[model samples]
Target: MKRLVALLFALALAGATQAQDGPAAEAEAAARMLEEATRALDDASAARDRVKALTQTVRAYEAGLQAMREGLRRAAVRQQALERDLAAREEEIAQLLGVLQSMSHTPAPVTMLHPTGPVGAARSGMILADVTPGLNARVVKLRAKLDDLVVLRALQDSAANRLEDGLRGAQAARAALSQAIADRTDLPRRFTEDPVKTALLIASTESLDGFASGLSQIAADPTGAPGPAAELAKGSLPLPVQGRLLRGAGEADAAGIKRPGILVAAPPRALVTAPAAATLRYRGPLLDYGDVAILEPRSGLLIVLAGMETTFGETGEVLPAGSPVGLMGGLEPDDDGIVPARLQDPGSDWTQTLYIEVRQDNTPVDPAQWFRTDKDD
Candidate 1:
C-alpha cells in the first residue's frame, strides 16, 4: 500500500512538472479559447444575436489587446515584439483564409478528383460515394471556415486599426515628452505662473457648464501659437478615427432625442485625435455621459468629443491636428451609456461610439455642416 501511494505521488509530481513546462503563449491561447467557448452561442441562437455576438467578440478582443498593451507598458517593453506575435497569428488566419478562398473557387467534386485518367476518376468516385458522410462533413466545415474568414477579416482590420493607434500613441508620447522639456524653459505660459493650477482647475470641474465658466476666468494663451483657423477649415478635416459614420448630425435616435452631432461606429479603444489644431477644454467626466473632452479650436467654436472610455492629455494642453486625445472604450455587453447618449443606433453593430458635437458661438451646430459627413443613410 505504501509503495502504491509513493507511485501515485510520483505520477502527480510528473504531471505538475509537465503543466509547469507549458509555453505561456500556448497557455494564453488556451485561455482565450476557453473564454470563447464560454461565450459561444448556438448557430440558431447566434443567428438571432448575430450582430450582438460579433460586437461582443470584437469588444472581448479589444479588451484583451488593451490588457496585453498595459502589461507590456508596465514591463517597459516596445510593441514591436507584440506586433511580431500578432503578425504570426494574422499569418495563420490569412493562410486559412487563403485555403478557403481556393476551395471556394473549386467545386467539391473537382477537389475530390485525381489528376490522372479514368482509373483515378473511378477510384475517387467510389471513395467519395462511400465516404459521403465525410464529404458532407467537409462541406459543413468549409461553410463554417468561410464564416470564420469574415469574422477573422473583421478582427484583422480592427487589429490593424488599433496598431495604427498604438503607433500614433508612441509618437504622441514622444511629442509630449519633448513639450514637457520645452515647457520647463522654452515654451511660454499664458494662463498661470505654474501650469499645475490650470490642470487642477480643468480636472476639478464636474460638469461642462462649470468648465465653460472657469475657462472664461482663464484668458486665452497669447504666447501660444495660433493654429490653422478651424472656422475656415470647416469642411476639410479628416474624421478623428477610422469608422463608418452611423448617425448624422440632427438625426433623432429611437429615443426621439435630437443632438447636433455625428456618431461614428469605431473599434473598441479607438484613439481620438484632434481633427484640427485645438486647445483641450475639458478631459474628464460630465453629467451621466462617460469620459469627455471639449476642444476650442478658435473662439466661439468648440468641438466636443465625448463617450471616450479613457482620456489622455491635461485640460489646457494644446495639440496639433491629429494629436491623440483619448481612446474609445469598449461598449461591453452590459454597457448602455452610448445607447442613452444617442451615440449608438438601435439597429447598429457598433462596438464603440466616437461622439462629435461642434458648437459655434456657444450654440450647437450640425457637424454635417462643418465636417464632410460620410454617414450611412
Candidate 2:
C-alpha cells in the first residue's frame, strides 16, 4: 500500500512539471515570431522608403503579440496532453522500479525488467528541460529587438517633418527676390516724369556739385561758341544754338513757380534747332510738355526739348547739332490749370529757369559734375 501511494504521488508531480513546461515552450515560440516581425520592420526603416514601412512594422508587431497570445492559449489547452504524457512516463518509471525490486528479491533467475528503458525516458526529460530554458531566453531577446524597431520609426518621422519645413522656407525666399527686382525697374520711370519730383532731383544733383559750378555749368553751353559769359560756360550742350537762353538752368519764378529746360525764350513761331548733333529718339506729346522731342547725341546723351509748337523730327531720324528739331510754342496749361511760363525749382522757390536733367545708365546722376567751368566767379 505504501509503495502504491508513492507511485501515484510521483505521477501527479510529473504531470505538474509537464504542464509548467508547456506554457514556457509556447512563450518561446511566440517570442521568436515577434523577433522576426521586428527585424523586418527595422529593414524597411533603414531603406528610407517611407512611413509605410513603419505602419507595416507596427502591424507585424501586433501580429507577433497576437501570436504570443495564441501560444499562451495553446499552452493552456495542451495541459491535458502534458498530463497524459506525464502519467505514462510515471507509470513506466514505477514499473521499472517494481521490476528492479522484484529482481533483487528473486532467488533463482535475475531477470532485468525492461533494461535501458528508464535511461531513455530520463534522457527525454533532460532534453525537454534544456530546450525550455533556451526558448525562454530567445523570447527575452526578441522583445528587446522589437523595442529598438519602435524607436527607429519615431526618428524617421521627425526627420521627414523637418525636411518639409525647409522646402517651404526656400520657396518663400525666392518669391521675395523676384518682387524686389520688379520694384527697382519701375522706380526710375515713375519718379523721372513727375515735375515736382524732377525739380527736387535736379536740385539735389546741383547741391551735390556745389553752388558756383552748378549755376555756371547750366548757364553755359558746351558748344565752343564765343558769346555771353553764360553762353561761353559749359551748360547743357546746345545741339541747336539758334534759340536764346530764354530761362537759365537753375531756379525760376514765373506763374506760381517754374523751371524749364534751357528755356530758349525763342520767338513764338521760331524754328527750334537741335542743341547738339543727335538722333531723334522720340518725338511726341508729353504729359506736362505738350509737344516734345527727345534727341540722342553721339556722346550717348539725350536732349529732351519739351513745350514745343510742332515737332519736325521723327523717331529714328538723325539730326546734326543746331538742326531744327521743333518750333517753340507758348506754355500749355497743365493739370494745375496754370500754363506757367517756366519750370520751378521747388527747393529755392526760384522760377523761369530751364529744367535740364542728365542721366547715366538710366539712373539720374549729378549733371553739374559733368559740366565744365571755372570755380572762381
Candidate 3:
C-alpha cells in the first residue's frame, strides 16, 4: 500500500520530462513555422514586388499549416492509442486498485493470521513478497500511460488556437497571392497567344496528344518558341502541388478509364506551381479534364496540369520555376469556424485531385519518372 501511494506520486511526474519528445517537438516546430509565416505576411503587405512576396508568403503559410495539422494528427493518434490501451486494461487496473486498498485498510496482525494455521500464513507471506515486484511493474506501466495521456491532452488543447490561426492565415495568404497574380505584368512573354488558332485547335483536337501537337501552331509568333529544354531536370522535378499519389500513370479508374497521367490527392485550395521554367501555352477549359494549365518547358515538351478550380497566368507568358499556376478545388469548412477535417481525422481533407501529365516529343510519359515519387508527403 505504501508502494502504491508512491507509484501514484510518480505518475503525477511521469510526463514532465517525457513531454519534450515526439509530439511535443512537432507542436513546437509548427509554432516556429507559423510565427515565420506571420512575419512573411507582414513583409508581403509592404513589398515592392507583391507577386513574389505574396508567393513566398502563401508557401510559408501552407508549410506552417501543414506542420500544425500533422502535429494535431499525431497527438490525436497518440491519444486514441493510449485510450485503447487503458480501456483494454480496465479490469486489471480495477483489481490492482482493490488489492492495494484492501492492504492499506487491513490490520497487519489480522492479515498474518490464516485459517490453515501458521504454515499457510508463512507461505502466503512469501507469495506476496514475490508478487510485489510484478505489481510494482504494472503500476509503473500504468503511470507511463497516464503520463502520455496527460501530455497529449495538454498538446491538443494548446494546438487548437494555433491551428485555427494557421488555417486563417493560409486562407488570407492564398487570396492575396491570387490578387497579386492578377495585378502583375512584369513577367516576360515568349510570344503573344493567337486566340483564333487556340480556339481552332481546341475545337479540332479530340485528345491531349492532338492538342499538345497543335500547340506550336497557336503561338502568334512562329519564330518565338520556348527558350531551352529542361533536360537536366528530367528525373528531378518537384510536384507542382503538395499531395499523395492516388494512382500512377495509365492506372484504370472506377469507370475503367485509363489515362496517361498520375492522380494526386490534395487538400482544398492547395497551391499549384510550375515545376520548371516554362511558357504558358494554354490555360482554360479543355476537353473534359476541367480547368487546365499547359506549360511548354521547351519546344516539344509539354506539362499538363488539370482539375484545378482556378488557373493563373496568361498564355504565352514565360513563367519562372515555382510560379503559381492554379489551386485545387474542394468545399470549405462550415461557417461555425471548425478546423479542417484533416485536423480531426488525419489525411481526410485531401478531397481534391490534381492530374499531372508530362509529354516529351509529343508523347505521354509517366510523370513519376520526371518527379520524385518516393516521398510520402
Best-fitting candidate, measured by lDDT?
3
Candidate 3 residue runs with Cα over 4 Å from true position: 3-6, 9-17, 106-130, 220-231, 332-346
C-alpha TM-score for every candidate: 0.44, 0.28, 0.85
- Worst window of 10 by summed lDDT in candidate 3: 332-341
Better of 2 and 3 by lDDT: 3
Between candidates 1 and 3, the one scoring higher on TM-score is: 3
Q: Tens-digit lDDT track for model 3 on 1-377? A: 46655575566346645773787689889889998988898889899988778888877877777677777677777778889989998998888677677677777678879999999999998998898788777778778778788877777777777877877888888888889999988887778877788888999999877887888666446566446456546668888888888999999999998999999888788889998888898899889878999988877788999999999999888888889999888864422222344566666767889999988887899998888777744
Question: How well is each residue in 250-363 modelled by candidate 2, as lDDT tens digits?
Answer: 546576454323444432333355555555545655555566665545333545556665666344445544445554554211211111223121111111122344443344
Q: What would the per-residue lDDT of candidate 1 be over residues 1-377, giving only the tens digit for each residue?
A: 22322332343223212111112233244335334523442231334434334333333434444442332222222223334554666776466445545555676566656789778988976875685555345445434433333333333333344434433433343333334323333222223323675577657877554555566556666665454455556677677765668788878888998777888777655556777878776677666668888777877778888888766565556666665667677632322111122222332324788888887766777887667666521
Considering only N, C-alpha and C atoms within 3 Å, which residue pairs clash in candidate 3?
none
lDDT of 2 at 93: 51
Candidate maximizing TM-score: 3
- Residue 183 displacement in candidate 2 (angstroms): 44
